[model samples]
Target: MLYIGIDLGTSAVKLLLMDETGRIHNVVSREYPLFFPHPGWSEQNPEDWFEQTLAGLEELVSGADRDKVAGISFGGQMHGLVILDENDAVIRPAILWNDGRTVKETDYLNQEIGRDRLSEYTANIAFAGFTAPKLLWVRDNEPENFARIRRIMLPKDYLCYRLSGTFATDLSDASGMLLLDVKNRRWSKEMLEICGVTEDQLPQLFESYEKVGTLKPELAKRLGLPEAVVIAAGAGDNAAAAVGTGTVGDGRCNISLGTSGTIFISSRQFRVDSNNALHSFDHADGTYHLMGCMLSAASCNKWWMDDILATKDYAGEQADITKLGENHVFFLPYLMGERSPWNDPMARATFTGITMDTTRADLTQAVLEGVCFATRDMYEIARSLGVHVDRTKICGGGAKSPLWRRMIANILNIKVDVPACEEGPGMGGAMLAMVADGVYATVEDAANAIVKVRETEEPDPELVAKYEERYRQFRTLYPALKPVFQEIAK
Candidate 1:
């Protein structure tokens, strides 16, 4: 039998088809527009995502034996605010995870509501990206629209509800919403009250591999699928990517370098950082994990290459960026503000230490190293907690770049393993569906059988020494600029 994995991303919906044995048969992607009506605001029409995802699914399974498709699952961009009216209509364009419009709301939660209480309720403090803050933004600014809300959901749950006739979300995805009692894997009543939301407004929670429902009969028929096809509640993008890379069990780590960068470490235990820098969330594999997310990763390079350099040749541009750690140029990857260690929405991207002799290659290398350094910030935090990671699985858009992969390996001073099937969340989505269909006993069992390392990038001692010093310097720059960032915001 076959399974379908749909990865609902920020820019596009990527669909994948695979048999029970994990061989990918076909893949399709459909792009949609991302809108920015205000400087710090990011939004996307839910209708646009729906249309593109449906079209992509049709194209994904076009040539395959659609009748054999047993299940469908999702891995999606997390923490987007998608609200529905009583009539089940999308109330507004979704406020995205990278949207920084919730700075005020986040402050209200962190300062007024108090981070200690918020963390006690949800196992996380306030961040501009979380759903709770976005809800406050809507309530304060668009009271009429907020009053009309009947249901609240993450980006992929909207798709799940539309396609499967079920309003549900999984633990891993819900963990980022700042609405879930993540340690307990349930809705936090205190958080709900604080956000002026009720339990009825939220979707039912499921384990990531659990079956939500079967596909809607009409959707299944139109798409040449059986009505009995299962719909499994999938995970947040990072968690799904972690599962895809086999970063399961205790102490395993994975780094995702997509539009957002993340360092994910799976832990059997539940523990939040003292500084609340890392996110403590339930994992898809029936355990707990910690994640540190950066708002911009590969997108930084994309902005530099496309907007600044005016070129489509990303590979050619990186080909000349050979001097890894000797460069005086430094870049702070905060284009969409920042998350993880620094929850500063006022932070702006900057190029520091650029001299008159700094060449284009130095600038490009700085962008790559900057992202790696930011990831290392998370790694160091995890180390401070005694997690002790010596190797990590790498995935996402930046993981495709050999230069970036090498830089991450050395910068973090850990071996980076590239998965044979580096499809990330999509592959993991399908694997979760397989578990839902009883093809596997557990998520870990499925992962152990399917995920394979294609190659490993090892760190060099000299390069590690060079980056150790550079990172020490890189760390100080953020602290110095933070006061400036706050001043500029004012």
Candidate 2:
């Protein structure tokens, strides 16, 4: 049988098809516009997602044995607020995960309501990117639209509803909403009340591999799919990427360096750090995982290459960065503020310790090292929680850079394995569909059976020692600049 995984991303919807044996049959991507009406504000028409997804699906299965298709699922951008009216029409443009318009709402949640209380209720604190804060933003800024809201949906759940005619979300995605009692695997009533929304507005939650519903007959037929195809509840992008990389089971780790960077550690047991530096969320594998996210990762390199150096040849630019861990210049990767340990939306990027001796290679090396150090900050927090990670799988766009991969392995002092196929969330989404269709017994089993490692990058002790010292200095810069960042934001 064949399964389809839809990755509803910020910029586009990528669709993948796979056989029961995990061979990718076909892949298709459809782009959609991301609107920025104001600086720091991101929005998208939810209907655009559905339209493009449908169009992508048509292309994804064009020549496949349509009758053999067994299931479809999704992995999507998390924390976007998608509202629907009583008639099931979209109420307004979706407030995206990257949207920064929720500063006031986030401040209210973290300050007025208290971070301790929020962590107790939802196992998370508010950030400008989280859905709960977006909900509050809508309620306060556009009360008329809030009054018309009949259902609240995450980005992918909106697509799931359009596909299956079922309003549902998975635990992995819901965990990020700040409306979920993550530790309990349920919705938090206190958070619901605080958001001024009811439980009825929320979608029914399911496990990532659980079957939500069969695809709608007419819609399935429209896409040349069988009506009996099972639709599984998929997960948040990082969780789905973890599943794809086979980072399931206890102590497994996956580091993603995309537009954002994340250090994800999977565990059989649920655990939260006392400091709450990492996000404690349910995993796509039906257990738990802790994730530390950095807003800027590969984008830092992009900004340097595009905006600063006026070049598009990233490889050519990185080619000169031969010296591994001895650059005197240091960079702080906070281009889009930051999340995870710092949780400071006011934080700004900085290039410190630059001397006249600093070459272009030294500055480029600093940018890469900065991201690795930020990831290490999360790694240290996870270790403090007694989560031992000896190695990790690496994926995403930045993982394509061998230099960055080596930097990560040395900085974190872990063996970094690269997957044969780095499709990430889209691949994981198809794997979940396979599980829902009984192609595999469990998520772990499916991952073990299908996910293949291509190569491993080992850290040299000398390099690791150098990076350790550099990381110590890198960690201090954030605190030193915190006051400055706050002042500038004001």
Instruction: Report residue 428 deviation for candidate 1 (angstroms).
Output: 0.7
Write the residue-wise lDDT of candidate 1 on 1-490 in tens digits: 9998889999999999998777999999999999999999899999998899899988988898888999999999999999999999999999999999988899989999999998899889999999999999999999999999999999999999999989999999999999999999999999999889999999999999999999998998889889999999999998888888898899999999999999999999998997899999999998999999999999999999999999999999999987778989889999999998999999999999988898999999999999999999999999999899999999998999999999999999999999999999999999999999999999999999999889999999999999999999999988999999999888
Distance from true position, residue 32, model 2, in Å?
Answer: 1.5
Q: Which sections of candidate 2 miss by over 4 Å?
A: none
| lDDT by candidate, in order shown | 0.93, 0.92
Error of 1 at 216 (Å): 0.7
Task: Name the top lDDT candidate.
Answer: 1
TM-score of each: 0.99, 0.98
Model 1, residue 34: C-alpha shift (Å): 0.4
